[model samples]
Target: MRSTTPRIDVVPAPTPAASLVFTTVLTHGPLTRIEISRRTALSSAAVTKAVRPLMAAGYLVEDADEEARPSLGRPATLVRVDGGRALFIGVKVTGDEIIAVLADLCCRIRVARHLPVTDRDPGAVLASISGLVQELLTEAEGFGVEVRGLGLAVSGDVDRAAGVVRYSPFLDWRDVPLVELASTVTGLPVTVDNDVRALTVAEQWFGAGAGISDFALVTVGAGIGCGLVVHGKVVSGAHGVAGEIGHLPIDPLGPPCHCGNTGCVEAIAGDAAIIRRVREATGAPVTDSAGALELAHQGDPGAREAYTRAGEAIGRAIGAVVNVLGPQRVIISGEGLAAYDLFAEQIRDAFTASAFGTAAQCDVMTRPLPFEEWARGAAATAIQSFIGIDTY
Candidate 1:
């Protein structure tokens, strides 16, 4: 009897140069062959070779730019990725909700969905993800394209190579084989990565970090997370845990962290920490981040103090990252940005106080990325895996 399992089709790039060429075009295209070569640092001949197969595969398309044509030369032709060539799904598993996006080969989000996750059990999360993927797959049918892959992004220690989520404190999960389980249920090639790192991939390719060689993405919300890009590559430490700025112990006498550390950045600055502090300080029935934020905005001294402290912790954490890596820029994002007004001044002051001489020159800016963007980041990871890029 014949087997009934669906077979996943791997995209054909065939060489590192091909992958480079494709990425260059995807990120900075409708470019002429010469522009692609210049951007990728590949020889014109190599760019031509790479483009040939991709265009033949319908993954790339070329168009004549009559207006861009030089009077003395052949009409300038531009090459770009064919976004409709393939489809992908990206899911971001947060502490309380699941954000999923249906995207194309170019990583453009076609649709987004959010499902509140009341249960954090591994089985429940997997089932939610599988259902989301099926919905996305059905949506893909309308585009007449196959859903090529699925990407899952979770907070915490993720071993992308091993396809396992080693530890996810937010989800109270440890040693979970997420990729295998998700792939088995969805029947599509799956890529699993740390949520922040996955977001970094999207930033590196298309967001504020684009065209920058070294940058850091720091997220503040339920958790304080950092994603580092050095020499134009996302740094996944040998142990699959890098840019863990949240766990950096800043105050010896500070509050205890779930990671078994005292005065950690997250302990002082995360949403839970802020809420706890607000409740203790105000003696109010502050049950959630929203209530705490409202209290602060309403001139509650205790709540304002809590935000100030969190801001100080976050600033110091960014300073530590700048001191250590000297990235050109640090992009602060995540859901916690909702309270940026409450802590902006404190964060700046603390960062200035902690950063050493030249490191203080690093630019720090905030960009509020919705959960959909994070899901799209997950999709970007799947696209990277499909194109044989080093997402890890």
Candidate 2:
């Protein structure tokens, strides 16, 4: 008798140029073969050869238009990834909840699910993730496509190569082999990455940072996290801690951070920090970000003061990033944008005061991305894995 347990079939050698072709279409898709060759620096024959298998495998498709022509006096048919091809599972684990999605190969969310977590322990979180993935896997069965991989996006220092969660402060987890555990439980290949970097990958491929070679994604929420993409690649420092701008020391007398530093960006700008400062200033039991934002919107002096300081701290952090990397743009994101109106002016003022010369010219903008988007970013990581691209 055959074993009853369902299992994920192991993928054979994924195409070599699959990564180059996939990445080309991911960042600059709907392009002709000629354009793909030009962008990826692959020869035209190579692009066609690389794309043929993907098209045959249903992962990519050519546009219907047959009349489009390149400037070189040649008819060029555009090619794009099929968003409905193979499905994928992406999960973003936070302190309070798990956000999961069934995304396509092109990283579009075909379905989404969320589960609240009262427990931060690894076992509990893994149980939650397994249940969610099972649900998505059942959903994919309806679409008649395999769920290729599972991507988990977590906050803090993560070694993507080692597939370990080194230290996640919010979850109180240390040295957890999350990828191995999840893959075992779900019977699917897994890719785990830092939440901010995962978000950066999605942005680089599909969102605001698309086509920009150098840009920064600064997340302000429970913690301050920065993801830097320079020269067309996200920088993961040699030690797996490249853009820890949250821990960058800017003030010596500021509140103490969990990292044992004072006046770090997170210490001043994180949600907990803002709440602590608000309670101290107003003598009110402001319990959460919503309460603080309400007080500030109500013209409460103390609440307004807390946000003002937070804005200044964040702006200074952005200035520091600009001073060092000189990115073409800095994107301010996270759940913190709900309070952006309260501190937008202060952020601009502090950034202007702190930025030096040409660095100040770097575009600073706010973009609100929901947790689903972050999870979709996790799916992006799996796509990278499938294409055999380098990942952190």
Candidate 3:
């Protein structure tokens, strides 16, 4: 039986200056009003005005004075987001599992839960989502805070403005009204976006991408997903499908992708693809990515060779991103990193070979973010919507 959907109380107004001020405070606080003004480049008066409503609503709280503010002629008080002001829920639906987190206003995870996914149909996935959301909602009750919103992160071409999953190749979904359906069942405002894009939000604010204006986040797991942030903003292209690096056609003779394209990066390096290649190379009855990895770990030449090729494909994809966007950094992450040792050399070699000129100098690094962090990224999206900065 479906549980009753509890209603969330606050609906934040999406004001431009207030949103900017609030986010600046979020990423670089507890800081003084003067610091906020300087960082945001808003006039002191504008900062004060923007801080008013937020303070009044108990979202921004003034910290104790660290030093006197003689220059700004204001109280020497540090300001930081009151994380306990409200709470949110973030859900990351992978092909194998559903991960949910209950987070505070600051996007800190207070509680988390994981559930196996036995079915991939929209109805079954929604039911699984509802169950996890209900669990998180119950957990939120212990904090004595209102749960403000829910964020849903799935892989594929997602239309954030429309709250629709235009197409999720991993789940074989098309034109799913995810936000509306999720809101109907959860009774909270929902923000649905591409999983990689959602993770990029957390990366921009809290991970390696912090303070960097331009970078790319590439996830290598069940799928090869890329999220691009250009000029400090997550690029969503005019058609809601920017940064589809996973589908870059590196080889016309390569494997076919679920997107009906051949030789796409994902078709070569994605987890399923790697597993398939491993099975073909070793003639082993590998059923899952874990089994495939185990074979490679056991010193099976064929299995290791499969991962090496996957790395090469990924490196070429990264090279393309650098040549086109010229980002400051490229961060590689995802569950696939569990096998990084097997492919690290190939990735660097191929990237070096394919990158052109100064683009080759782009910093390339790997980060192992658990599925929970992806769920946290989902929560960050909910926080973004609550603060009216859903531009991501």
Clashing pairs in 1: none
- Using lDDT as the measure, what is the rank order of every candidate, best first? 1, 3, 2
Native-to-model Cα distance after best TM-score fit, residue 377 in candidate 1, in Å: 0.5
lDDT of 3 at 222: 85
Assess every candidate by TM-score: 0.97, 0.94, 0.94
lDDT of 3 by residue, 322-387 (tens): 999999999999999999999999999999999999999999999999999999999999888888
Candidate achieving higher lDDT, 2 or 3: 3
Answer with 1 or 2, whichever has the higher TM-score.
1
Strongest candidate by lDDT: 1
The sequence of per-residue lDDT tens digits that candidate 2 reaches over residues 200-226 is: 999998889998999999999999999
Q: Could you tell me the lDDT of residue 29 within candidate 2?
A: 83
Off-target runs (Cα >4 Å) in candidate 1 are 1-8
How high is the CA lDDT of each candidate model?
0.92, 0.88, 0.89
